[model samples]
Target: MAQLRSVPSRSGRGRTLLAATGLVLVAAFAQAPSTALAAGGPVPAAPAADGPQLSYVVNAVPGAVETRAVARAVRAAGGSVVVAYERIGVTVAHSGAPGFAEAMRAVPGVQSAGATRTAPLRASGTTDIGRPQKVDLKQALGQARQVERARGGTAAGGEPLEPLQWDISAIRADRAAKVDDGSRRVTVAVIDTGVDDTHPDLKANFSARQSASCVGGRADTSPGAWRPWDPASDYHGTHVAGTIAAARNGVGVAGVAPGVKVAALKVSEPGTSMFYAESVVCAFVFAADHGVAVTNNSYYVDPWLFNCRGDAGQRAILDAVGRAARYAERRGVVNVAAAGNSAMDLAAPKLKDTSSPDDSTPVSRTVDPATCWDVPTQLPGTVTVAATGAKGLRSYYSNYGLGRIDVAAPGGDSTQVPDLPAKNGNVLSTMPGGEYAYLAGTSMATPHVAGVVALLRSAHPGASPQEIQWLLKLEADNPGCPASDATCTGTRHVNSHYGYGLVDALDAVRR
Candidate 1:
C-alpha cells in the first residue's frame, strides 16, 4: 500500500513483512487555543481519566451552520481541532480524554466521529523508511549500453540515458512519448511520501507552486517543504513521481507522461513513515484546490488496514477520506490509488487483517469484505489499480477483487515466470540523488495509470473526468485470463485480475 517495502516477499506466498515504522501521534493541538469558530470554539473540559493521546476525525454536514455547531461540540468534548477541511466538512482533532470519540459523536451536527489510531501520541516505535537496494554501478552501466546497442544507438529524439527500463516499453509508453510527450499544462500530483524535485529528470517538470507538505493534517506551502526531509529514508514518492513525469531531457529514465508537470503533495510523516487519514485528507483537498488534473495514491490510509463502516472510529475515517476524494473528483481531478500489495482478494466473503493499528500492537482479525474497506482505492469515484509482472501476469503481491479493481498496469514481479530483465524484474526509475533503482508493487503500477491519464488529459483538454475514465477503460488492451492462471476471473470484457486489461498509452494517445 503506502509503504511498498512492507509488502510480503514473493517467496512468502502472500505473507506480508511488517514495516518497522510506527504510526504518528498527535503531538499537540494543531491550532492555538482561541474561541475561533474554525478552531472549534474553545478547548473543552479535560476528561476525568487520562488516556493515550489519540487523534479523531469529525465529519460534519457541509455548511456554516452545521460546521460551527460541530466545532462547538468538538471543543466542548475536550478535543482540539487540528485542521478543518471546510470544503468537505471534515475536521481533524486530538484529545487525551478517554471518552472523547463518544462525546464528539453525540454532537448535534456531527455526521461521524472516532479515534484515528490505537497508539498514544508520541508512542515508542521504530521507523522503517524503505531504502532502495544499492545497484552495482558497473552492472547498471552495462545494461544501459546493451539496451542502447539493441535500439541501434538511441531511438532518435533524446531517449533516456538508462534505456533498459522495459516497463516503459511494456505499456508502449516509449512509443506514445515519441508521438506526443504529453502537455506541460496537465499536472499530476504524486500524493505519497514526497518527491525529489531537484533530480535532473524531474526538476524541469516539477510544479513548485502546486507542491506542498500535508504532514500534520494541514498544508504547508513553503518552498521545498514538499520534498522528503530524508531522501534516502523515503524514496518511494520520488520514484513514483519519476514514473509519472520525469522530464524527457536525455537523463536517467523516461516517464509515462514525461512532458507533463508533476507536483509533490507529501502526506507521509518523516519520523514514523505512516500516512494517517488527516494527512491524506489534506493532500486531496490541496490537490483539488490547486488545479491538479490527477493524483497518484500508492498507499493505504493508516493505522487501520481496512476501515469498517460498522465501527464508529473506522466509519469516521472512511467518511473523512471518502469525502475528500469525492470533493477532488467533483473539481475535475481524477484520483488513482493502488489496490494494495496483499494478495488476498478484496471481494472475498472474509479476510484476515494483521496490520491494523500498526503504530501499536496489531491483532489478527477476520473482517467482512463488504463493510471493511481499503480506501480510497475502494472508495467511490476513484480508479483502483491492480499490478502485473514483466510477463503480463498478475504480480504475486498485488491484491485483486472481482469488482474492486478498475484497471491493471506493470508493477513488476521479480519472480515472474519468464523474467524479461534478468537482473531486475521490478520497474526501474529515477531515485533520489540522481540515481536509479528497481522497485515493485501496486505502488509502482498506479503511476502508470496516472501518467496515461495525464496523456488523455493533454490530448483532450476539454474532456471531463467521466469522459477520461471512459476512455481509459475503452482504450485498454483486453487480455483475458492466460491458460491455467488462477488469478484471472470473470469475463473477457472486465475481470478481477486484469480489470479492463492492460492500460495502453499508445492506444490512449491515438484515440
Candidate 2:
C-alpha cells in the first residue's frame, strides 16, 4: 500500500521562534520531516543518518521531450518511478536500487539522482487573541469595523481584540491619492501549491480568462477542492493570491491590488518534487504567453540536498526561468520570487570547511549563495524579496545579502510588534472554502511585493520590468538603523538582510 499523508499546517508563531532562537538551534528544524505532504507511504524500517529517511529521487534528462524513456530507465534500474507531474516534469519513487544514484546519473536523458522531500505549505502559530497592537494612519485609512463590529461591542470596550484587521479601504484611499487605480487589470501568476478560489476575498482576484490545475487535474475553482476550511494539497498559493489581489469587495481582507486579476498556477504540492528549473522556465513562458504581468513563486528546494549536480535538467530549468523572465521583462512582465527563508546564505548552517558566523553573536560578512542557493529564484533576471519585521528592521531569520535580495517586504512573525503603520502580527487573507486565514513567510511576502508591482504596472502601463525594479530599488525608504542591533555597523543602504528597504506602497505609488 502506498503511504499517503496530508500537508501539515504549521503555526507561524512556533516557526518564528524556531527560526529566531539561533541558527545552530534552527538547523535541527530544517532536517525535521517536511510537513508539506500527507504521511502514509511505506514505513521506513530505518531512517537516514542526516535527517528523515529520504525515498528515491528520479532524474529527467534536461530538455528531453521523452518522459516515458526516463520512467522506463527507472523501472529497468529496479526503481518504481511513477506520478509524472507535468507542471515540473519529474517523477517520484518508492525506493532506490543499489548504486542507483550512479546508474541514474549515467542513464541517458537522466539529469541526476536524489530523494523526494516535502516542504511546509502552511505557516504555524495561534492567533494572539489578546495581544496589544497599534494601528498607524496608513493602515487606518478605511476602517471597516465601526463601533459595533469591534471586539468588545457597540458600547465601551468592544473592539475586535484579535486577528488585527488592516483597513484595506484606508490603504486604497491613501494609495489612490498618489496614483490612479483604474480598471487596469494586471494578472499575477502564482506558481506554488494550488489556490483556494472559493474564498470570498480570493474569488474577486481570480480571473475568468483561464485557470488550470496541474494538481492531477482534480482541483477546480470550486470550494470542494479545498475541503472543510483547507485543502490537502497546498494552501500556500491561495493565501498568496489573496495578498496580491483579493478583491476590493467589503467581504474580507483586501489585497495590495484588490482590483487586479490573479492567474492561479499550481507548481508545488505534497507527494511531488519541486518543478524542475525547466518547469519554472515553462511557467514563465506560460505566464507571459497568457498576459500574466507578474509571477509569484514561494517554493524552493535545497540544492545541496539534491547533491548539487547540475546537468541538462538544471540548465534547462535555469534557462527557462532566466530567459523566460527576461522575455517577460521585455514584454513588461515582473517576476517576484522569495529570497528563501534560510537565515544564512545558500550554504547556510553547513558550510563544510568554510567559515560560518558564530551563532552566539550577531555577525555580518559578505557571502554569495547564488552559486549555492536554491534554483529558479537565485537565477538572474528576477527580483528576489526578503522579509522585514514590524519595526522596519530585517527579520532575524530572513536570508540576507545585497546580491541576493532586491527588496524587503513585511513578512511578519510573532516577535514582530505593531510599529506604526506596520503590523507584524500577521497578514490575514483568503483561504480555501470561503474561509480566512493567517500565514507568513517569504512566500507570503513575495506576493505583497508582486501586488505592488501589479499596481505599478497599472499606473505605468509601459514600464519595463527592469525599470520597475529600478524604481522599486530607487524609491525604497531607508529605515535608519544605526550601528546597533549587534548585527552590523553603519547605515544599511542595500544590505541583503533588509534589501533596499521595506516595500513602501505609499512610496512606490508616489514614484
Candidate 3:
C-alpha cells in the first residue's frame, strides 16, 4: 500500500521530520504493493463535514468584489470567515454546520469549497528544548575540522561546518559562492513548519518583516510568530532555512545563497504537524504579496498523499492550493517543491492510496494519477525537485518521473557516504537552539535548488519567474540514469531519474 512516507532527519545521526505526506521521520518507506491494481477499487463517497468543527477553504474569483459575495454566502451558510485572501481567491472558514461546503458551493462567484481536514481542532503542545551549547565550533568540531578542512577549501571565508557540508560541494555551491553569494534584495520563503530565526546562522539573514505564521489559515505577525512550534521535534523548517540562506557568517555553516534573505511562512499545525490546505493557501498568497522572490515547499499539502480529483473535497483542496501557487508565480515568486520521498514513479499510474485523511484513521482507495496530483510540486509552473546523494546519483528515497521532475540536488543518503567529517551521509545545516544537525530527504534537496534560484533572481533582477525557471533547467548538469536501475527511463539530458540533471549553483551565478 502507499503508506505515509515522512522520512525525518535527526541531529547527530538522528532523523529529519517530513510532516503529512511525502515526509521524513527517520525511516525508509516502500512504494505501493504489487497487488495494487488487483485489490484497489474506487473510493467510497464521504459525507459533507457537518459533524465536527472543521476548517474549510472557500475559493472565490481573485478580487475583493467577488470575495465579498462569497463571504456573505459563507456567513449565511452558518460559517465564519477565518481569513479572506482576495489576492488568490481563497477564503478560509470554520464551520460545523450541516452542508456548509455545499451551501458555499452554490454561491454565485464561488469556484470551490471543501473541508481541509478530517481531524477536529485541538491544541498541540510545544516542547522546551535544552539550552544550546555555547557558540564555539573550534572545540566541538575537534578533529573532523582538521581532516576535511583541507579538502573543503574556504569559500566566502567558510564556516566551521563547511568542511562537513558535503551537500554544498555536491552541487558546487561552494564555487558558486565566490562568483556571487546572492543579493539581500531577494527573499526565499520557507513555507513549511515554523523556522527558528533566532538560530545564529539564520538570524543575520532572517527578515522578520517578511516572516509570519500561517498556521490556522490565518497569518499571525506577532514577534517570533515564525519560530518553530516545538523546536526539538519541529526543527524541519529551521534546517531547511539553514540550507537556503543561513548566511556565510564564519560561525557554523553557510547556506547555498548566503547573501539572500529568508522568511518563514509556517503552515504546519502545532501538535499534528500536518500541512493543511487553508494554511498552504495563506502561505502562497503571503509570499506573493510580500517581497519574496522564491518559495521552497518541502512537503505536500496534506492528509492526502495524492489527492484525487474524482473526490469533490480533495478537488477543492487541490484547486485552492493551485490558485495560491499560480498567484505567487504571477507576482514573480518562483516556487520550488520537493518531489516527495516515497521513491514512487510519479509519472506512472497510481492505484491504491492508503494515506488519505492522515489526521484520522485512513481507508484505502483507488486513484488515477492522471487526475490525482501532488500539490504545489506537480502543479503547473512549480519546480518539482528530485533528490541526489553525495555520489551524484538519485537519493534512494526520492520520487522521480520522466516529465514530473524539474531538477535534482543533493538531499543526502546514509548509504552513499563520502569521505567527509559528518560521516553521516545526511546534509548538514543549522538546527534549533543555535546548533547544527544532519538530515536528508527531498525536503533537504529542495532548499539547494531554491538557493540557486535565489542566486538567479539576484543576478537577473529583471527576469520573470518563467525566465528563472527556464535558466534553472538549462543550467543543470545531468548525470543520466544509473546503470544498475532498469526501471528508470528518458535521455541523459532529461531523464526520469535526474530530470534536467543536477542543479549547478556555480552556473546559476556566473551564467
Candidate 4:
C-alpha cells in the first residue's frame, strides 16, 4: 500500500488497545475522494487518545457515531469523550476519565480502541533531516535573477526571466546533443500539489490564464473552473513547476523547456500531505478537456486491492485517468507519469523479493500479488518514466519493465552519485524563490520527457501525442548489456528496465 500515516507508538497504553481497534482505526482513516471502503467488512472505529491529541483520519459513517456512546460511558467512569467531526467520528482531546481504557472498552458497539503511531523523538540512525541535498534555492534564484535581468526587468509585470544557479547548461547540452530544442514552446500540466502562482521562477511560467485549483473546491475561480491559491503547501507546486518549465534567460536552473507554458492545477490541498482520487481525476479531466500538450503526474495512489477486489472507487478513478489520457490523445496531448520510488518493478507479476540490493547481486523489486489489474505504470496511453543515475545507469529505485517503462533520464541518485551536493546529485533544475534544489525519483525523470515532448511539438507543431511518444521510444539509446549477462532480458535490444534506452535529446529533436 502507498498510504502514509503518522501512527502513534504502540509501546505505551496505546499498545493495550491495539489488539482490539488498531486495524479498524486504520481502515477509517481519511481516504482520497475516489477511495471507497472495503465492502462487507465491519465499519472501522475511530482511534482513542489519552491527552490532547489530533487525529488525521476522519470517519465516514452516517448520522450518530459510536464515540458518543463511548464518551458517555467514559463520563460515568469519570472521563469525557469529545466528538470531533460529530457526524461520523469524534476527536477525544483528553480521554478525561479515570480508568479511561476500562470505561471505553465497556461501551456498547465499541469493538477496539488505541492510540496512533508516533514519529521518533529525535534522529539517531540514518534518517536525513529536512529536504534532500539537491534542492538549492540560492542557485535557482540566481539563475532566475539572471534570466529576469536579461529580459530587462523583474516580476511578472515586466519581469526578466529568473536564472537558476544549477548547471542547467549541462542538462541542456545533454538533451541538445540529441535534439535541437525542437519547439521553443511546450505545455505541461502539473497535477500534484497546487502551485504558488506568485513565486519568482514559477510566476514567469505561470499560465495564469490556463491555471486552475480544484483543492479549494472552487473548481474554477475563472470561467474555466480554476481555483484560487491556498497558502498551506506554498512552495511544493511551484518547486515542481519550476523544475519543468521555469523561464530560462540569465538566472536560475533552466527548465527542460524554458519556453513551455504550464497549465497549473492545484490537486493537493494546502497543508494536507495526501490528495483525494477525485482531485486527481478532476485535474486530469481539466487537462484533457483543454489542449494540454503533455501532463505530468508525480503522485501515486495507495493500493486498495487487499480490501476490495473490484473497488468501484478505484475503478472510477482509473477510468477517469484512462479516459483523460485517451481524450488527451485525441487532442494530441501526451501523459507522462512517475514510476513510484518504492524500488520495485511496477510491471512485475507478484511480490517476492524483500532484500535490498547487494554489492554482488542486482537489486530486485516487489509487487503486490493482490493487485488484480495491471499497475498504474502499465496503464494504457501514458508514458511511465524510470530514473537513472549520474553515470547513466538505471537508478536502484527506478521501477522497470520493457513493456511498462517507455524511457529513462537523469533524475539523480543519492547512493551512487553522493558526491554531487545533495542539490546536484542526479539533479538538473531550479527551485522556488529562484533557488536550486537537487531532487531524485521518477518525479525528476517525468519532466525530462515532458520537455522532450515539448521539443517535439515545437519541431513538429502538428505532431500528435502518440506520435511524439513513438518517436522518443524509437530514438532512445539502448545501453549495451554487460558481457557476463548475454542471455539477460533486453540484452540485444530495448528491455523493460531501461525501456528504449536513455532519452537522447539531440536524437529526439533530429528525428
lDDT values for all models? 0.76, 0.48, 0.75, 0.47
Query: Number of clashing residue pairs in every model?
Result: 2, 30, 17, 69
Worst 10 residues of 2 by lDDT: 1-10
- Which pairs clash in model 1? 1-299, 2-299
Per residue, candidate 1 scores C-alpha lDDT tens digits across 126-178 of 23222345566567667677777765786775454446677788889989988
Residue 505 in candidate 1, Cα distance off native in Å: 0.7
For TM-score, the strongest prediction is 1
Model 1: residues >4 Å from true position, as ranges? 1-49, 122-131, 417-422
Which residue ranges in model 4 land beyond 4 Å of their true spot?
1-130, 134-185, 216-218, 222-234, 302-309, 352-376, 418-423, 482-488
The estimated TM-scores of all candidates read 0.91, 0.63, 0.88, 0.62
The positional error of residue 323 in candidate 4, measured at the CA in angstroms, is 2.6
True-structure Cα RMSD, model 3: 9.5
Which is the better candidate, 2 or 4, if ranked by lDDT? Answer: 2
| Model 3 residue 65 distance off true place after TM-score fit, in angstroms | 3.6
- Model 3 lDDT vs. the true structure? 0.75
lDDT of 1: 0.76
Task: Report the C-alpha lDDT of model 2 over 242-301, residue by residue, as the tens digit.
Answer: 777766555555577766788776543233323333234445555665688888866552
- Give lDDT tens digits, candidate 4, residues 1-511: 1111000101100000001101111122122222222233222333443443211121222224454444445445443232222222322222323344444445566433322111101111111111334434455455555565665766432212223222233234334523453343567887655565555555666676556764421235354233223332233445456656766544444566666677677654333333333344446556655567777765443222111125433343344334445645676777776664545554556744332111112235443534433323445778877766666666656656546677776665555453222334455444444444555566667667677677677777887777888887877777854454322256446776667767666665565
